[model samples]
Target: MDKKTILTMVLAGFLGLAQAQNNSTIAEHVKSATAISKVLGDGRKVATVILEYDAPISNRSLSPDSYEVEGKEVVGIYSNRTPETAANGTDGPYVVIEVKAEVDLDARPAPPTEAEMQEKKERDRMQGGPGLRAGWSTGGSDEYPGNAVVLQKKEIRTRTGKVYRADGNPIVTTVETCPVADRFTQEEFVSPYTGQTLPYNIFLPENYDPGKKYPLVLFIHDAGVASGPVKQPLYQGNGATSWAEPEAQARHECIVVAPEYPVITVDDNWNYSHHLDTTIALLKELQSRYSIDSKRIYTTGQSMGCMSSIVLMLKEPELFAGALLVAGKWKPELMGPLDRQNIWIISCEGDSSSNTLQGEAVAIWRQQGSDVSEATWEMTQTREELSEQADKMRAEGNHLLFTHLTGGNHRATWFVAYGIEGIQDWLFEQHR
Candidate 1:
């Protein structure tokens, strides 16, 4: 059977402050500013802005009213060179301004038109491309800024007690930093067993030291992005980026590996592919190359990727401490005692395909005394409610976690699932 790949929704933005020309003395000194973005549960937003000044500025003279930001609210202002707030004093060259940025990144892309599809098919035929024509991915949209952070100059007192008003438009010229995913570097992997090549994006923790060991997360993409591009796994959904986010890292401090399989790794019937073999090879190579905590290694994926992750765990159950399977399922008979291992199965309540298969598998696990913890959550619940339930389950000491989400569908289930910090926390806490 041909692998029926699942395509995913894509909602992808930046801020600017490059040149400020005004009559005020401070205007001449202000060349531009950099906007730092962060991926929150809602989407991507400008977390802070770094103003580059040619002279020293007093923190006491700077306030939230010192600048007018378009489409954003300035919460507090500081002249510290670093992103963090500092004591009120004279800090030189750079000023960090905190911005209130909470926006949603959940827009879904429209399906292709008939003409567009025909054009794409013709192009594929001309190029002799491989793989099913339906595969899609989110390559780098979430990591890079998609919208702008506009800053407007206002009157402010300099350190010398001199007042200045440039009253000029401050265009945000650069987006120099992104939290967590910023540390990810692009690399390639080639299988020594099958000689097949795969391109992937890898994230290492800050101040990585070989003297200490860090846990690792292996994120597999859904069929949606398997054939799209090299880094689609990172952009397709939060599956790859969630565990590496700053808050999650603060708790787990692990490495992340996201590969674009470029081919179907498994079919709906559990037919396997060579890419799975290469994935295992890549993981083994990474263990030898980095100080990865082997006992804490975990696998998580969506759809086709989810099934492949299960196959990986089955092929070498000893290599995985736990697994988070989202929006995907396999037959209970062919699952091979995996219910006895640490696994969490999550699916949207209304997704007939996923729910039917997952329910059957969970039933089998329960029959065998797998001691699973099952919960149904509303996708509209506030973070506090979700976290509260997650904390409760975390304390249950069960190896299997099955969550059925209401008010959500299959494709979008992952978007909300990855943003659930409570579930991420539980994943990190598991160990062999």
Candidate 2:
């Protein structure tokens, strides 16, 4: 036999010997698995799957192809010591599989047929809005509720170069992963005024110190997430989570609160429910519990939540220092002296009612002796561009800034609007 063939035979013999020595199958050694997911720019995505072994596992290289996650693209595979403090391991008990995740609300396969296009057109006409997307979509929510992962039985090698066939029975399994959204502790408040209960998700900054005061962000959800599962809004968009993100916290650490209402907060006729009042009540309760900077309290929301925010601003103008209202509109006549308040209203030019009505509110504010700075920005503008526009307005000493995003639509407006750091900074700077 040739030298190469002889080498191959010897290597196969070594592998067989290694396999015989390592009698524990992979499934037998697996203790547990945790699936890790995180919020992306527009929505949340599954990011990693980690499995724990029964004993300390020697560090070894494992190809990503050894694992399969349903509907996710595996990007990396490595050994881990723990889910948290999860640095790559030298001799750890965990195996990690990282994946490229897609958002659940926007995962539809495209190249829509003519029939689908016509249906989308008809739906747009019927709904009278863009970005409705022929379904109850809000450009928010996690892509994976529970993804099935498989550890395929295959030949793998140890760091010492010993090869073994990773035998396993029933490779399909579910990993229990913790999303950052789960960080928000679930709580409820009973309003004294309305005798109503408001369920909310509150995220206190890590290492929260009561001696040091922190600002609080009140996030109201759109009609899409107004119904319960209270965490819907927390995962739906960046409204609440953006404030609590590590990067944002590194600059300005604050608390985030999101209230989920069982009923719609507001309707087209400008009517509202008692839930808004209870939301404020919940805020007051939070203030009594935590050391909150009352002057810097901010309120923000989208669609129904935005409308509810307007109502709150009008109801107790003294309560909030500023408001970030997105993709929503109020009757110009119903709009109070919102001009006097530090308000930033964002809407896409493609959103007819929101654009027109929000424009009217701006015009009304301009009429009310308020210097409002208005900007019509392109949808393609970089974050720097948006920040620059916002900076110019803030520097100009404008209380109300009206930004009309060109060529986008209602549901997608908040996803883009909330990502601008300038807006978040401006909100933090406001005081009652």
Candidate 3:
């Protein structure tokens, strides 16, 4: 072969090797596998196929408007309906793929240009909001070693509609439905007090009994998915998934209610207090509709939702038996009434933004004669360590329990906070 042809063949071989390695690494990160299935439209013809991967799929492997099934080009790709975190933490791998109408196989957009990359960096820095620091965006140039090509916030764009494959005949893959999603019933409540509507997801305990009163845990979503869509909280954060696990249900046997309100609660600052009144009304309605233990109602939230939970407690301390606030600060204005409620505060030492707030809350509770105790926790701690901490907190005879977790990132710390053993049991033990 000529010298130019020889060089071309060598480069192609190297690229193939690199791709194989990438796929291997991606597979290892997947705790469970992605479930892919065709979505048929009118006449039972293939319209789209849902791709549910346990980990984030690489943009290079599945780019918008570039996927294909049996040589039939995918017309578009959509992921807006996907939950922000899916089953994993925000930084963990959990992806949902949507394939739109079809186009010619040759119509895929070219690889992102240098100009496009630069533009996205600038936008993500300015408008990417809180979780941006988690390195969710694949940064640096493509030539940067180990820097995978992730779709930047600005690069993820697609339309939702029907488009046919070029050949009018598309092969499809099928899989079972997601069991996590199957158990939830999507619901919306209209508050008569404020006339405001709130969408929520409710998971009924498998052993639910109408005549018997069971404990209820009200979970609030953080800023990202809370406002734009109705069921965003069901996927964006760990609170929903944490409570949905069969282990949790079997242990607690309580009803779980996750409310999705309209408005970004936490961003540069936490502000769920913006719609506090409407939220209170929503809870009142839930209480009337279900057989809830009046003395065992509990509340918990992360970030923005945490801030709002504090406000909710301050205004209606008599309503909640206990609360666990994660990654949020304590507002001094509400300090006066906080001691009335049993509270567990969790924050990561690395999350400097919330450390000061947590400290202030802890001090105030102690000063007010509300029993208070402090402890350190790490995600790697064994079950024995977890139970020991729970025992110590209970012995302190304190109204407030403060835990500082190490070895966790600020954006994804909620997963670690909720995963600690005996923590939920502690919440369940409290009574008004």
**Which of the numbered candidates is closest to the native, going by highest lDDT?**
2
Candidate 3 off by > 4 Å: 1-176, 266-274, 382-388
Q: What is the C-alpha lDDT profile of model 3 across 1-432, one tens digit per residue? A: 122322233234334544444443222222222222211100011223333343344333334534444323344443322322122222212333333322121222236788856765785777554343221222222210111111222222112222212232221232222334335688987766666677788888766788989888888766544444454565444576566566677677788888876654444433343456767787788779988898998888887778778878877879899998988775654565787779988887877877777788677777777777788877456646876787778777776888887855454457556645468878888999
> Which runs of model 1 end up more than 4 angstroms from their true locations?
1-28, 41-44, 56-100, 103-106, 110-170, 205-213, 223-237, 245-250, 263-273, 331-333, 350-352, 382-384, 419-425, 428-432
Q: Sort the candidates on TM-score, descending order.
A: 2, 1, 3
lDDT of 1 by residue, 50-88 (tens): 666666676677766777666777887777544344455
Rank order (by lDDT, best first): 2, 1, 3
Which window of 10 residues has the lowest lDDT sum in candidate 3? 36-45
Question: Local distance difference test, per candidate?
Answer: 0.69, 0.70, 0.57
lDDT of 2: 0.70
**TM-score of every candidate relative to the true structure:** 0.74, 0.77, 0.60
lDDT, model 2, position 63 = 66
Please give the distance, in angstroms, between residue 278's alpha carbon in candidate 1 and its true position after superposition: 1.3
Q: Between the candidate structures 2 and 3, which one is better when assessed by TM-score?
A: 2
User: Hey, what RMSD does candidate 1 come out at?
Assistant: 8.3
TM-score of 1: 0.74
